[model samples]
Target: MQYSVLGTTGVKVSKICLGTATFGVAPTAQDADRIVGAAIDLGINFVDTADVYGNMPVFDRPGAPAAADREPAEQILGRTLRGRRDRMVIATKSNGIVGLDINDRGLSRRHVIRQVETSLRRLETDYIDLYYAHDPDPDTPMEQTLAAYDDLIRQGKIRYVGLSNHPAWQVTHALWIADDRRQQAPVAAQVKYNLIDRSAERELGPACDRFGLSIIPYAPLHGGLLADLRVLDREVSGDQRFQGSGFSESEIATAREVERLSRAWGLAPYQTSLAWLLSRPAVASAIVGAETVDELHANATAADVELEPAQLASLTALADQPPAFQHRAGDGPERPPATTSSDPTA
Candidate 1:
């Protein structure tokens, strides 16, 4: 497997990170054990999970059980990594409602501190390699949130800090706060970046480049849309992400184009998609989840598939274009009031 430096940190991580969002949900605990074991054999050293990932149905169903009542992904991972904890760079997040208490969510000092303790216990680990604020909390002051992270680092609870699902402005603001306070700054940013959605390239890409942060992109396959375009033609079964209505026509067309290009290049659709993402600027790793050992083996091969410059450009051009927004008339440089001054010098 190819390895890269995580942001400006000296730590080396595998190009592919094993995502555990589906653990104990789609795949049972036994299935997770095999999948994780396969990832280790494939040389993947990074795993990403969260406190609220194991019980995803609760968010969709109104009367579903509370998240705390379900077995979280962290606990499943803990059992799976009993003898092999040191072999992976573990990353998890907080800021989601995991309990019924009013103080159970957000990036407040209380929530952050409480969740870290719970996560450590569930993961059976002394220190988490990276901890993320899963989402931005507008109610809590950034200073309070950052200060809590700084304190955690000093106490050796988490080695590094990261942010997920936060805008570019908020990311830069957090960095500024860390710099001004001499606290532990974030080294990575996680977002839903994939072949189908290239929105992160608009601002987060540049922000990460300027601030020395690595982009760890999740959903690199766009919920299996890029993996196989044929799913659009057939009736998709068992996959909750595409059960009700499936993808939009435009989305399907985009995936079909990606498939055509992959065939022309003599590569599988998934390999082509993942290779293109790994080649993008500021991207350190792409997180992929698998339901079985065979699937994990297939996805891990993308780490070694290097695309040619032309191939990379083709996939980039096929990505969904960002929505257009007209700039206000006065936003740009004025035309010098119709250039009434005749002199070129004027």
Candidate 2:
């Protein structure tokens, strides 16, 4: 039930953000209701969704599923929000695919404007609490993207601006442009961060702190890598939805430490992983997707689990190895300025 302000936006969000990449699929509206309802019961007020998040469990791949198969995650989430709109902080992204046309994607002015309007309609809301540029769109100039967001803020279509899967330099660069131009700067940055994957800590973490931008880490469980790696050895259920966060030799080494610490703390590996993420700097919230109501409740209760300072240090030291692998997006020192039609944004 703990909460923190989203960067410097003065908006309070739950420590655990409910990620809806699995919506409209396995955990359909009926199951989604149970999961989201449990999250609300446990005090989760932050929810993250992307326009191209339907049909599958995750969206890190590009163009495999046709446009017809991909349903907007926002639409599914929007329908579920019905009366609970005011009870949660709603966040959705653009710069992803809504159609097969060339102009249906990217962070260009035309695309951003058109996407936001459609998102507003599909979300069944006049304003989105937070809006994100799904990823780095190199084709479009940064100023054009910022200007589009600026207009949205001015028009009351979106309150705060943010980015997902954007690197440290790109974030700082955008902030520089926004500050210099007196435009609305981003309040948050979302990335694939978890106990097993600490790449964002190298540069993005420091940049976020310096720019007064909070970090909303998606895939906080590392595709169930932090959830539990036993499935790698033994054929365990619930490993399908988490296949995106692949495993590696070094990652398994760190995950072993996570299990040991979890045992000592008397908590599940997933819960311990989430608690560790909540303890990081500039981390406003950590987004975790749950398949069932029980899973949702378990993940939400991680907010109450606090690791001792020494314990956290030990966990960090174990996870401080070289980048072995990443969730869906490979661990690269520099992520190219790329935004795809399949914005699973997981």
List, residue by residue over 30-62, the lDDT tens digit for candidate 2.
Answer: 567677777878889999987777654344233
TM-score of every model versus the real structure: 0.88, 0.87
The runs of at least 3 residues in candidate 1 whose Cα sits more than 4 Å from the true structure, single-residue gaps closed, are 58-70, 233-239, 242-245, 323-346
Model 2 lDDT, residue 199, Cα: 83
Q: Pick the lDDT winner.
A: 1
Give lDDT tens digits, candidate 1, residues 198-303.
8788888899999999999988988788887655554432134423345777777888898899899898898999999999889999998776687678888999
Q: After superposition, how far is residue 155 of candidate 1 from its true place, in Å?
A: 0.8
Q: List the residue pairs that clash in candidate 1.
A: none
| Backbone-clash count (model 1) | 0
Pick the TM-score winner.
1
